[model samples]
Target: MNNPTKEEIGRILKSSKRIAVVGLSDQPHRTSYMVSKAMQDAGYEVIPVNPTIDEALGVKAVASLKDIKEPVDIVNVFRRSEFLPEVAEEFLEIDAPVFWAQQGIYHEEAKRLIEENDKVAIMDLCIKVAHAMTKTH
Candidate 1:
């Protein structure tokens, strides 16, 4: 995956405040849950978007991006590669500033769609690592 510089990532994080974590799991050991918890503890308001669970992190778990009422600053994706296209489609339906595809996630077509229509920022990186890297500088 193409990783952005510490400075660039930090700037993006600083500019973004509200994040919708797609495919966020309820299990404590899951990547989604851990990342969500880290993000929440770091001051970002994370809205968990999980279909199976009704709540996560003591907050209501929205079934989909469409279920989120307010505008989000970023949509953080943790789903598999096969689901990216559909997720991107859903993302286009919403009004967000950026689309973040975590560590192992990436989709060129989805990236193109987001940039072409909404022109939102895309970061295919680990939010946790980004936070750690950002804090060091």
Candidate 2:
């Protein structure tokens, strides 16, 4: 998997404030839940996108990215790598500026699609780590 340059990661972390956490879980033990919570604590507004849940982290969750009427700065994904193509398709329909696959996930085609669409594509990077990295400097 191709890693985003540090500069690119910094840019994404700096510019994105409203993150749509795709496949975010309601259970606090899950990685998605933990990361989203950390992000919320870090001052980024997290919008949970999960079809099975009605809410997460005190915010009402939407069934899909398409359901979010507000602008999403970044689409932070927690789904498996196999689902990225579908996720990319949904992202294409929205005005999101960045596509972020979580720490253990990456999909080449999806990355290609997101980059070709003039959006930033970041894979296999923990959003919390990236955010912290930016804060240090």
lDDT (Cα, tens digit) per residue for candidate 2, span 9-99: 8877877789999999999999999999999998899999999999999999999999999999999999999999999999999999889
Worst 10 residues of 1 by lDDT: 1-10
lDDT of each: 0.83, 0.91
Off by over 4 Å in 2: none
Residue 75, model 1: Cα distance from true site in angstroms: 0.4
lDDT of each residue in 22-79, candidate 1, tens digit only: 9988889998999889889888899999888988888899999999999898899999
State the RMSD for candidate 2: 1.5
